[model samples]
Structure formats: C-alpha cells, structure tokens
Target: MKKTITATLILISSCLLAQPVPDSPAYEHELQIGLAGVSSQSIYLGGKSQNRIFPAIDYQYKRFYFQAGDIGFNLIDSKDWEIDFGMGVNLVGDTDRGDSRLLKDLPNLSLPVSGFISAQYKSKMGLFKVKHDYEINNKHNGNSSSISYAAPIFKGQWLIMPKISYEHHSQEVVNYFYGVNTVDATLSLPAYQTGAVNNIQLSVLGLREINEKWSFVGNIQNEFYGDEISNSPIVEDDQRLSVFAGFLYKFF
Candidate 1:
C-alpha cells in the first residue's frame, strides 16, 4: 500500500510538471473564513456518539489552499489537473446520552489529527479524483484511500460523484475506541477489531449562485461498506448517509 501511494504521488507530480504554466501572476494570494455547525443523530465509534460544531478558515495562494480550524488543509488548482492535500482534527463526544443508536455502548473516544492528499483531472465531460488520508493519535491510528469520478448533472447547478474507498486501522486504534476490552468481553460485549474496510459512495452536490460575494452549496452522500468490515459487532449499519448545506464567501 505504501508503495502504491508513493508511485501514484510520483505520477501526479510528473504530470503536474509536464503541464504548461499559466501566464497569470504566480505569486497572487487570497484569504477567506467561515463558521459552521453540524448536527447528526450518530457518529459511530464502537458504541459511542457525539455532536460537533466546527469553525473554519480558508486561504489560497495561486494554486494552493490552506484549510484550518474546522476543516484542515484542502488545496485545489485549475491551471493543470487539480491536486489537493487535507489535514484536520477529529473529535468524538461522550456516549452516555448521545443521539445515535450506534454509540450506545462505548463512551468518550476522541481521535485527533485527520488529513488527506488527493489529485484530480477535470474536463468538460467529467472529473476523476484520487485521495489518501490518515487519522492519528495516541489511542488510534488509521488510514483511508480512495478514487472517485464526478460528472455535471446540470452544468453550473448540480453534480454527481461516485467513489470507491478502502480503510485500515491499527489494533490499538481500533480496539481502544471501537472494541470491547477483555473485561467487557467477559461480559459478552461486542468487540470492534482492527481490519480493513472497503466501500462505495455516491454523492450529489448542488450550487446556487446568490450574488457576486456569496453562494449557497448543498450536498448529500450515501455509502455502502463491504462485508468484512461492515459485519463487525462494533460496526454500525452497512449504509451511511450525510447531508450538508453551507454558504461560501469569495474575496476577489
């Protein structure tokens, strides 16, 4: 897997260098910031649940974007094929009285330091993207990687994207947060173990250009995981869904 990731990154770097440079200013920069709150019934970790609020900032320099606060580093560029790198923090809440059915068993699991690196090629017909990510902390260590494709459903208004992903985690990472320990195991509690997860997702995003400065964006994503990972006692349902709506402010 490491070899594959290295090779893919090398190929992307080569392609980036082969493309002709744009004539525009190479040193130009921009900055933008926003705040957002997300409410969900459940974010499953073994048997834990949490609700979260995230505040975010975005800064761009020519072809790179910095994401901090809520979302981490997310870089995108149009001159050649688009490439992205992302890094962020992950927080999980106490499970005692949470809203999700999946989090009823475990309590208080937090995994910090989450991030990804990705690249894409876009054309009028469609776009193809590949990404790799990691989640690191004292208690947990996991990685995820994926490839996806997107096509315009209504030109400037909507898009449909499909993706296939794989995820793996260390035993400590998995067991600390998602598994039942020996003590709990003796009591017949289900344990979440370290393993690989394979899944597919379909996402749809819609955009509304409100004015020159602000725009509204909405998105929905649905995912289905493969049996090996999805069938675990610690695993939630095989299917997962997410919806988000947000406003973007662009500075010229």
Candidate 2:
C-alpha cells in the first residue's frame, strides 16, 4: 500500500507538470480523479524493476491545491510568474527492501516529507523554474534544489511538453540513501559515502482532451546519475527510466 501511494504521487506529479495551472482558472472549485500506472527501472543492485497501478486524485480551490499526497498554496499568481509554497513527499527514493535480496539486511529508508518553495517564469520561448526542497520530517535532514525548462507544443486537442532539468542532492541525502555504514557493511558491500552530486533529467509529457470531462495523459522520464551515485556499492545503474500513463475525469 505504501509503495502504491508513492508511485501514485510520482505519476500525479508528472501529470501536473504536463498541465501547468493557468493564471486564471476556469473553475473556482475543481476536482479530478483517475487511474494511473508507472513502470520504473531500478538503480539498486539486485533490485527488480518496479511497476505499480494506483488511483490518483487532485483538488483545487482558488490558490490552494492538493494533488495526490502533495498540498500547496500559490503565494504569487500572475500571467507570467507563479510562486508556490508546499509540502510534498520526495519522489525519487526507493524504500522497499523486499525488492532486492542484497538490500534486505540494510535499514529501510523511509520516504522523506519535504517543504518546498518554487518559482516559475513563463515566456514565449518556454517555462523556466527554480525550486528547493528541505526535509521536514527529519528523515535525512537533507535538501535538494533543481532548475528546469520546459516548452509546450499544441496540435489540435493534444499538448506535448518536453522538459530538461538539473538537480542537486545534498551529501546527507546521498548518504542516507546510498551510503553503507560500518555496522551495516557486509563482505559484498563495503562502507561507502559520497559527497553532493548533480543529476540530469529529461522528460516528455503528452496530454489529450478526450472530451469536456475526460482526458488522457502520459509521460516518459529518464534520469542520468552522477559518478558519485553510480560508484556506490549499492547502485547498479548509472541511469533510470520511468513511464506513466492515465485517464482522468474532471469534476467542477
């Protein structure tokens, strides 16, 4: 159930990225419900790829919004700029130990809840964003920041968006997820720690309005890891890929 919820949040986040909020929303109160699935490659050694299907829900009232497990408020809303403050579950970490025998002996890393502030700038060329997230749950007490750009293309009733992002994870975040302490180290897995690293991500999102109340959405995302992460004993891959798709019904 926990893994299902996590995957749902990830897919919801992707879908939301594809459809940015308009400066002036069409509805004062809005709700959307859907079914979504995600297939993701595992970056951990001896870890199997994960596939999950779960329900998605999103709600909005004026400047406040809730999407899946994320809740936020818009601090600034304008035609060209948007600033938001929110709390959300971090989407990138794997917490399940049952997925890999090699990881069974290690302590499980719970998903971190983070508080974030983000700013977005829209222009004719594209949308540019900068965001920062800090762990509020004391899980790792770490922080992350990202910069991204996305451009949208429209064709008839379909919208396609392509995005590229650069992300930085603090050393504490990396250590909590990938590091092996002396006590947990095994013959096959030695103690390891790595400094901060930067990662790159590329994604494309597609959405089609099936009708007034129904819509379809899909996204493909790929992440390339930094050398620090790839060199970790628990890591087996230098990259990960994820694909998600869903159909949604909107209620106003």
Candidate 3:
C-alpha cells in the first residue's frame, strides 16, 4: 500500500504533468483521496482471509511526500533515482479462533508503528525500489526489507503496472508474530523461533483516467511465505493474496 502510494505520486508528478515543479519549497500539494477495498491474510499465523475498504491518499511537495498512511522525505535525487526515509503503521489486528481449531490458543499480538528507509530507480523498462522498516515502541525489535520492480504500460488514457517483490523479515519479527512462547505454548505447540527472508509477492495495478478530475484504479496482489513462516506450527498455508479497486477524484 505504501509503495503504491509513492508510485502513484510519481505517476502524477512525472507522467501526468507536462512540466516538473522546480525546487521551490513553497508549493501547494493538494490532497488526493480515493476509496479502495483491500483483502489479505487475517493474520501471519495463517488465519482466514479478510477484506476491508480503505482510503488511499498521496501528495508531494519539494522533497517531502505523503501517501496512504506513510510520510517521508527524499534525501537524494537524480534524474531517475531517489532515496527516502519514511514511516508507516503496522496493524496487528486481533485474533479470535471462533470455530477454527487451527488458531485455538494463539495469543493476540499488537503491531506497532514503524519507520523505514527506501531507495528507488526508474528506467525505461521499469521502476525498482528497496525498503527497510524497523518497529518502534513494540516488542518486535527487528526489521524487514523489500525489493520490488514495477513495469508501466501506457495506452491512451489507461495505465497498467505489474510488480514483483521479495521481502525478508528478521528473526525478531518472525518470532513476534508466529512463535509459540513458553507461556503461550501447549502440549501440541512447542516454543519456537523462526528464521529470516520469509515473504515473496507479485502484483498488477490498473488505472483509467476519467477525464481530468477522476481516475479509476484496480490492483491484484499475491504473496507466498517462505519456510520460516510456513513451517510455523500455527501456520496453515504458505500463500496469501489480495485484490483492490477504487476511484479517486482530484480536488485541486
């Protein structure tokens, strides 16, 4: 969500505009709001899939940028490359087993807000980016790094982008979400800790410019967990996927 936020912002600034804004700090970057529906795994321990509607936002001024729930500033910029420091929140939602015996006794975990540094490069073929985020004010003390590529296909008023990404989660992050601590472990669940480099993803995004005031968007994303995550006793599956579609009206 956060990466796409920035990608859309880049699309707006570079592709949508006929001229680039100079390095003037005084600019009115308008607020862009869009409605979207996102679906994905309910929990990292391999729970059922869940879907919800969320608002997407993206705006930029000078070197500072804000998108979705992330905020950041570019520290380096070339004609086609940039490095930025950004922050986003982690929503470690609650868990209820209900009738699912697979999640019988897994204690609920709290997700904390996180900060990350990201680098990006845009080429005629595609856009490449790398990001690493660390948890703040939480028991999860590790970080995750993601490397992704996005290819843009432009046809008249329609824009399509396909993306692939690989993510690596540190040991602390894996354990915090999927491990069975001694206190929470039962006879069937043994205390365990996971390893690193645990997630891979692929996605495609579509956008239709509805005149100059509105744009329609749709996205499909899939994820496959590595051994560290799939091998967990609490995990039931190794793959997760999501689809999102929405519309945005430009006010400025």
Candidate 4:
C-alpha cells in the first residue's frame, strides 16, 4: 500500500512539472436542489437490498461550491489560477441503509473531516484537474487523490473525461469498516481490511439545451480499481459501469 501511494504521488508530481499553468479568470456559479435515488439488483454482504431515495442540494458562489445530501457535506473552493481547496465529510453508500446489518458491520461509516487541495487548468486545447484529500482527525489516517483530463471530441455537445485516483488508508480506517478485532472474529464474519486502492475511470458526457428553463444531461462512466482496494474481502468488484440520465432546470 505504501509503495503504491508513493508511486501515484510521484506520477502526479511529474505530470504537474510537465504542464504549464494557464492564465485566465472565468467564473461560473449557481444553486441546485434535486432528488436522487438508487436501485440496484446486486446482493450486498450476502443479503438482498432494495432501492433507496435521498434529497440533494448544492450552492455555488464565484469559485466555491457547497453540497449536502445522504453523503454528508462538502465544500469546494477554486482559485482563479490553478489551485483549489475541498473539505467535507464523505459518507459511503448512495442511499441511507438505516439499521441494517451492513450499517452495523460498519458502524463508523463517515470519514469525518476529509480535506484536500487541488489544481486545475483549462484552455482551447483541453482541461486538467487534480485533487488530494485526507482525514483531519482520527486514529487511523487515510488519504486520497485524483487527476483527470478532458477534451472536446465534437465540440460543445460532446466531451470525454479520463481520470485516475489513488486512496491509502491506515489500519484504523480499515478496522472501522473491514477489521474484526475479537468481537467480529467470534461472529464468523470475514475481516474487511484493505491496504490501498487505485482507480482509473473514463466517462463520456453530453449536454443539450432544450429551451430556456430545461436542459438535458447524460453520461456513461466506467471505473477500474487496483487489487488491494478492489480485492478486499469487503469490496464487491473491481470494475463498474454507470449510466445516468437527468434533466436540469435552470432558475435565473
């Protein structure tokens, strides 16, 4: 795990050295509120699960964006130049699990104060975004980071975004979710410890303005992760493909 995290950091550092930061100041801001639900036909932890719903909201001012939902709260601020800061709680699961066994097995499901800094640059050629974050206060430390690039394949209507991310968690973080100290071991449940994980993802997205108040959004994303992270006894699979269809309503 340590070796993988070191290599990922070195690669991202090399990429930063290879590219020159762009000079520009274009700002966009908005507020959004919506409802989200997830329905999956997969068995989790050897049990059948059902679909769930949750409310979501987001607020943006200048280069800052704030969001709150089932996943907790997130605050993102961008510098006009190529720098940014993000801080928030990252709650797992797309929907609330309530008092299910899944939640019981993972009691401390929230990564209480995860913070990271990022750098991003965009121009006529393409766009680049990088971010790194870690736990603020905890016995088990965990950190994660990602870098992504996007370019226009067919101009404004279509685009492709490719991203790579790495995550490292200390024994504390792993124990909270997958570890079984005597209590869990006696229950005959498998331990959930993980060393580190890396993820590579590719996504294709399209935007269409339907009229003054409505717009159409669609995207397909595929993700592949590294072994320690993906092969963990707790992790379901190493790959995933997701498709989303939604309508955006604008208020101005």
lDDT of each: 0.47, 0.81, 0.63, 0.45
Best by lDDT: 2
Give each model a TM-score: 0.65, 0.94, 0.80, 0.64
> Every model's Cα RMSD, please?
9.1, 1.8, 6.2, 9.0
Which candidate do you rate higher for lDDT, 3 or 4? 3
lDDT of candidate 3 over 78-124, digit per residue (tens): 87877988776542222331124566667654445678898888788
Q: With candidate 3 superimposed using the best TM-score fit, by how many Å does residue 55's alpha carbon deviate from the native?
A: 2.8
On TM-score, the candidate that comes out on top is: 2
* lDDT score, candidate 2, position 36: 80
The residue-by-residue lDDT of candidate 1 on 105-124, one tens digit each, is: 44554434556677878677
Task: Score candidate 3 by lDDT.
Answer: 0.63
Q: Name the weakest run of 10 consecutive residues (lDDT summed) in model 1.
A: 11-20
Model 3 stretches with alpha carbons more than 4 Å out: 1-27, 42-46, 90-104
Name the regions of candidate 2 deviating beyond 4 angstroms: 4-8, 11-18, 21-26
Over the stretch 15-49, how does candidate 2's per-residue lDDT look in tens digits?
Answer: 35326433335468888888888888888899888
